[model samples]
Target: MPFDFSQSHFVLFGLPTTFALDRAVLDTAYRKLQAEFHPDRFAAADDAQKRLSLQIATRVNEAYQTLKSPLARARYLLQLNGVDTQEDTNTAMPVDFLMQQMEWRETIADAKTQRNVDELEELNRQLAEEITELTVELAELLDEQHAWSDAATAVRKLRFLEKLNDEIGNAIEAVLF
Candidate 1:
């Protein structure tokens, strides 16, 4: 149980430290590591070894979660490259993007007020498309161009979009139920 907390998530998973990754490879590595570090495998070992196994298993889970999520992975990569996402410290965005966000919010509000599931579904579709586009841009910025600042900005946008998506899902559920 040689645990190295200093190792990056990618290093822990034997992955290249980059934004772009093969999902299959990541999933396979995660499963392999999970099985290897599973506490049950060390159940008969000494207390110290069992504790170490639990710690290693927890670390592996955390690494897998962060590496699997696009937004988290992007943020981690930016941090590794010496860029702070400034998710809390910096809220500034392009005026147009801000306006778009406001408009989307209004649209969601309208749909909720009217109890229109169809409208909510349409809005969800649009938001998903926007999220997909932003994800592609994020990958390009982090992997190909190494645009740290822009990548940080993109991460903020994705965070907002994800929140909005969750809200939309909640609203839809409310309307249906």
Candidate 2:
């Protein structure tokens, strides 16, 4: 309940305002904040206290979720710097990336139709590697270079990859069962 709602999520978690964060540190901070602001702790208090506690708990949970996710953290950092990703309206991606996306979708469809778990798993590994590489690049662009525009592009690409990754996961599940 000592939390200031106006503070940025990074400050709320006692973290630097950067895209790259230590998950362990975030997890620890989240646990501590949750323990302090948990609604049950204020159950015996007055209604106002309980309401405030619930609000703080909700904010803490939201901050924890945002920081824990790489893509979300990147987007949040961009927002903090007054850079809008414009994900909805700005859909112009590089041609190579669009081609790569098409290829990935084709591969996924084929793997799913054949129910090829091994193939799907291989595709998953490849996609994961690409994601990792992009994440590293994104960290450098946002934290080191301060290239907000490039970072926004990287975020858009990551968003596409994340969606495809979800589809791949579903395809794997369908193939399994």
Candidate 3:
């Protein structure tokens, strides 16, 4: 079949529509698609064919990226289920989660102020654990339970944890530097 831009990313990659995916399968499929539609392969083709190849290649890359990240994959599944996470518009997280987030921020700020590499590393470990736990919860919600609303909440929490993880890495760099 010809390439179809309108198809879902999972459909494009011949993957099942779920949050849990095999990384090896995704990598193989992405590489196969890249080899098939890479713009370099179209150098000798007509201008229209080259343009089409470029477009298909771009779409393939976008799909690969979206499917590769756990958070992105969860969000895409939620969107497909008609659940708009709406990060900006829907900011109503549980009160306990909000408090925990504040605590993490304060801990980050304190670690930065003290220039404590060990403490930063500890925080990074903690965040990594939380990310792992949430990822499991997300998979259960999205794949087994089909709990779209809970999955949306899980996606938002994962986003926050990811941002915090990045900040912790930056703090570690600053301390080491």
Query: lDDT of each prediction vs. the true structure?
Result: 0.94, 0.95, 0.91
Give a tens-digit lDDT track for model 3, residues 12-122.
889999888999999999999999999999999999999999999999999999999998898888888899987777878899988998998899889889998888899
Give me the candidate number with maximum TM-score: 2
TM-score of 1: 0.97
- Candidate 2 stretches greater than 4 Å from native: none
Please write out the lDDT profile of model 1 over residues 45-70, one tens digit for every residue.
99999999999999999999999999
Best by lDDT: 2
The CA-based lDDT of model 1 is what?
Answer: 0.94
How far does residue 91 in candidate 2 sit from its true spot (Å)? 1.3
* Pairwise TM-score winner, candidates 2 and 3: 2
- Sort the predicted structures by lDDT, highest score first: 2, 1, 3
Cα deviation at 156, candidate 3, in Å, is: 1.0
What TM-score, over all chains together, does every model reach?
Answer: 0.97, 0.98, 0.96
Per-residue lDDT of 16-125 in model 2, one digit per residue for the tens?
A: 99888889999999999999999999999999999999999999999999999999999999999999998998989999999999999999999999999899899899
- How does candidate 2 fare on TM-score? 0.98
The reply for model 1, stretches above 4 Å from the true place, is: none
lDDT for 153 in candidate 1 is 95
